[model samples]
Target chain A: MSNITNQSLSEILESIKSKKISSLELTQAYIKNIENAKKLNAFVTTTFDQALENAKKFDNKPNNEQLLSGVPLAVKDLFCTENVKTMAGSNILNNFVPSYESTVTKNLWNNGAFLLGKLNCDEFAMGSSNETSFFGNVINPIGDHLVPGGSSGGSSSALAADLTPATIGTDTGGSIRQPASFTGTVGLKPTYGLCSRWGIVAFASSLDQAGPMTKTVNDCSIMLEAMSGFDEKDSTSINKKKETYSKNLKDNIKGLKIGIPKEYRVDNMPKEIDELWEKGKKILKDLGAQLIDISLPHTKYALPTYYIVAPAEASSNLARYDGVRYGYRSQKGKDLIEMYENTRSEGFGDEVKRRILIGTYVLSSGYYDAYYLKAQKVRQLIKKDFDDSFTKVDAILTPSTPSSAFKIGEKTNDPVSMYLNDIFTVPVNLAGLPALSLPAGLDKQGYPLGLQLIGKALDEQKILNIGYAFEKNCGYKNEIKKWWS
Target chain B: MSLDKEKIKHVAKLARISVDEAKVDSLTKDLNSIFKFIEQLNELNTDKVEPLTSILNQSLRSRKDEISDGKIREKILKNSPKKNEEFFVVPKVIE
Candidate 1:
């Protein structure tokens, strides 16, 4: 069971397809792992019974042609799963079950993947650490006290702990990649319009993208193919023909130019991370790729600009949570306005409230031009910086996080400290480009460190191909002892 | 440019998320720090720069005006905290 559970998504699918193991066996193994690893708090809602039923159905009628046939996936709780409690790690929607399915998850199911459970995330996918989750913080499976980088901490932890084969998570800022880096997994933030955002809980609508988190880059490619497609429901969704990423994956880059952005070297960066970046550059060089030193001059402004843009969009998106249609409501209110105020006040976590306030202040009458408008204009300069760099290189490389995973409560209180975690990753989001973080090396303390590969807009294949080749030769593997279990 | 307690309270009210009176000072402090950090954007001059309203710079794909989705009234009213016969039930608005 452990061997079956520990296999990557591609490997698991191979075994399932060859009839070496039934879907029921695979799903049961994952369920056992999920049940045993309850201390990690990686799961917000475990659909074990439903998962077992789905596995039985898949087994009862085998569909070997499906991309993820009988492969049970536990996604970040932000995706709206029909009839399942999709809370998006907030109390406001704790009991809200959607009748309709999110296009991404629907596409996953259509491709023969079924639900395992709902993984935990930061409240409204806002916080950098999972500490802000209404359910509770997800402990890093690598070490109990260490924090799993968030807001997709649970997806990363569960993937690392073998609770799920390969999972999908929403990356707004560094949600997917940072958690994956902390847990020594691979996470990709596909181009913004590549994956439809019709049903995922909106944090920053423009920055939010659903991507794969997996133990191997091959599995990430397989899962990304399963989750992405064009949907009329999502107006921002790209109408490009569906890309066959896995089938067309190419790693033979004799002279492909990969960018090494100089601006990513921030002040006080740990020596080990700097060393890891050098190590990553060596791996790409070893893979017959040319490294060019380039600059994204506006990189420093990414974090500040994100704080304004994300919250401004968040305030507007979350306005739908008013006590009228759905979700948790306060019973203490007398009037309609009071009901809305009280419901939101009581329902949301402190981090959420702070963001809403920040968002409102920025988008308010007098401050709109000063904050929101200025941030948008700066956003253009940031995008232009990437555009200039992409002209010189096919992809860029940088350290995933400033340092390895910190303790759970280390930076929870300090907003700026937490925001700084995404400094290396947020620039990609601001520019709405595709980027992936793959584990390249470990720090002195044996915690995994990641290196990012940023590609031009709608060029996920190029990044994934580079990542696949890198993963094959990186030599860095997850030595995470199953201490939590 | 610092936000006082009164300003924090006012912003929270405008956002429709009630902040406790006692917590206003701390909230104000946090907002001010965030604001201070955001002040870095002001260092760059954008006199002729256009705001990036779109990422892909593609126009929104519009559909026909005809209703493409609907008729699931029970589903629409299912998650409501309080619901009447067909519509969501909220506190009375008019006297």
Candidate 2:
């Protein structure tokens, strides 16, 4: 019971069901852990009182009854939590609270998951590093002075620190998987419409998707089952039956064709990351899986295409945040137009402004065809690359990031360098595919290096099955020593 | 495309965001650098590819237009920074 915080979500459920530990006790343990890990800045808000209340309500319930009964889970600030401040890590929404819950979180709560609180993220889910958050960057619990890769940084750091049994994160251009990789956690970005985007603050509507970040692949599967479904509120939500991912988690991957995309190899990628990719191939190969070399020619254009499409959508989506409606407003303006300008200039962070400007410039009268339209057409090519590759393989394997986590301020000065962290991840979003990153090995600095498994559209089961096999055989350990304490 | 200060100012105006006079030069430099980086997309020949606006290519699912859920105007307006009685307050533009 003392080591309850270290248990996986499935183990916790088992413990609760056997009457070995009450739900309230587990909730208190996580609350204590979160209170002690403040220096990590993993949480923007901790709903401790409500968590205890919910745990008390489920203290006597049979755990086997509900999907995630009494599971203490954290939500990324990007998701609206009905009465809780749902800032998408921006000053503009610093005081904004939603009166409705996001469909994803609502699904979790309906399945009996208790709320641990809101986690930090990049402003409007913009940056690769958590440095763009207005509340400040979340520190990687694994090392001193390193950043937990972002937008979902707080969720990853909290899970790695054992402050929450599991957490939810939104992925747009690699927010969930990248942070999970940086923090030695497992994250799965389901197919674009697998989970509804109803109350999740929009980043790039086309790319924004919610997924599970957990300590194990098994937990990720169960959480995904509880979190995904077709919602009528979200127009883009796919009208399909929810997947029971846990039921399909098989350890055997015999004859499964895994594609190793040659385009994923970029210049100056750390030798350790490449070695981990090789190790992943060998592991799958030994598991009776055939490894095949494949090509995704439009892969290199993913980042630029993403930058264009994401910002253009972001510019349009974020235009609703005028001073009059909600959130922050500026009083310095002499007229209505000035007020709109002043409020936005003061409310948004530098990176956000930069992106909005890029979006505006691309969608401008003279440049629409060259930048926006060109990027959209290239996006089609990127998706075609995946569609062609998936025809030849069951799933694709690659390094999650070029390098492991670096110092907090290392790449802040260079915007393009920061954008490069998502090079290996953005293509999946572009194609609207499900992908997951599991810890495969540690780098030279002892930070976790993750191996990504990319699956075809609506084919998360294949990737999860492959991940289950890898998790069983990879021998990669992610247990931490509470360094943040 | 070189993003000089004037172009930066124009974009900012289009975006309805005010930039500090002192920061415009730095913003211009930043925009130019990012544009240069994105210029690599021009290297590829995409002659006949159609723009992919949606990933699913699934037809839009429309519902009969009606009030699916509402009657929460009080709750919705609760977060407004400046509100009077029933409407959000903003600086007068007509005057």
Candidate 3:
């Protein structure tokens, strides 16, 4: 049953329902692969023993009624799981285990999926490259030295490597979509409030959302249905009818209008990426979807705007970590104020601290109006750009990144350059819109390049349908060699 | 540059993260570069535009005044770095 570990989430569910494979057999295969793929550094914490126990329990009383149907999944460590250590790739929470489960993970468990382990991510989901993770960078399985696109890097790397069938990741300014693009997988960031934020370690509260990552678009649909819903506990969660995404996957898109945003064509973009965008447009056209050239005039300002808004919110959210209650407390403080200072200084990584300072500065007394409030006003204009464009197009199509995966340390020193990775994906988040990134094709060096479908807010179903049609006709099949094991 | 070592230090102090004296120079450089990039926002005039605190248009969600949850003190304190009985012990505040 080693091949079971290589199957899609939908395939695994079908196999289990047919009684062809037991949950134990499936979980064991994944556990064995995870043990051998230690070089990937994808997992921050392994729950193999607990996973086996749950699998055995499921095998004894298999229920085919659940959505996941006894599948095992590893998710980003940002989700707080009861009785398990949920570190947000920071030293501060290394010893802090949650006493409750996150709404998203709880939804997964209630759907019959058990935890496989916790995957690595950037510290508090801050960096574009997974390099900022305190657990260390998750190496892209595509190449030996490349950084898997990050914040949700471990989830992408592990999913692409077939270590887990389908996983979940949080997207705050492209954390989910960017990594999925680089890793040759499917990732979606639902509209701002599609999933609950409760029990997930807070990043930018307004922008942070958890969504599904998978090898195939259909599997992404299945996972999304199980993971999202309106929860009273999360005030931001949408209060609406539950979506049957997996049940509604359709390929016929005869008259769908897809906006091709002109501003996404940035200066000095790689030739291969331009060609990839062209190829994607042609594919969409051949699938009978009409393409319109549109402009999101505020595109260039989105990144700068995000840097201000995200960090401002992040600084406020992260102020909870002062070593008084949970997480790391420094041993070197003289008094109360010094203790708060010392704990934060030693506990957080450099990138985390950098953002905190930026946050603090922008929202500080004299700078608040010039920076934070100004960025927010500009953010409204950015959203208005999307709202106007949506009146003309059903969804917008763009490249997922300026380029494919880079070396781990290539842009770490220059924070601005690293931030440029999210240029194409950030605008969708700013508008509180749903977007999906699917592997469109491979780059010249064989790294996967992705095409994004940005839908109007609360229109995840539309993008998923569009993604399904494109994936079927694009003829892009990702082939990965078992190099890590 | 609006951000010098002094500005970074001041902000770090406000955020309660002690800046290592050695990192102030590099931190100033990084922060100044970010602020420089952020200056691009001024290129667009956003007069009369309301700062978007959230994309959702709904008013602040309110719930009825009623007890929804409580009595999980042990669970809450389970994560405290230093706890004694019913309270999380912090550094001497009165001293």
Task: Give per-residue CA lDDT, model 2, range A1-485, as digits (tens).
Answer: 77899989999988888889988999999988988899999889889999888888887554558889878798899999988888889999999988889999999999989788999999999998899999999999898689999889999999999988998999999999999999888999999999999999998999999999999999999999999999998889999977788988898999999999999999999899889999999999999999999999989989989889889999999899888888899889899999999999999999999999999889999899999999999999999999999889999999999999989999998898999999999999989999999989998889999989999999988899999999999998886778767
**What's each prediction's TM-score?**
0.99, 0.99, 0.99
Per-model lDDT: 0.91, 0.91, 0.92
What does DockQ give for each predicted structure?
0.88, 0.85, 0.86
Question: Residues A331-418, candidate 3, lDDT per residue (tens digit)?
Answer: 8977999999999999999999999999998898888999999999999999999999999999999999999999979998999899
Q: Is the docking of candidate 1 incorrect, acceptable, medium or high quality?
A: high
Candidate 3 Cα misplacement greater than 4 A, ranges: none
Candidate 1 stretches with Cα past 4 Å from truth are: none
Compared to the true structure, candidate 1 yields what TM-score? 0.99
State the weakest 10-residue window (summed lDDT) of model 2 chain A. A57-66
Of the native A-B interface contacts, what share survives in model 2?
A: 0.82
Docking class of 2: high
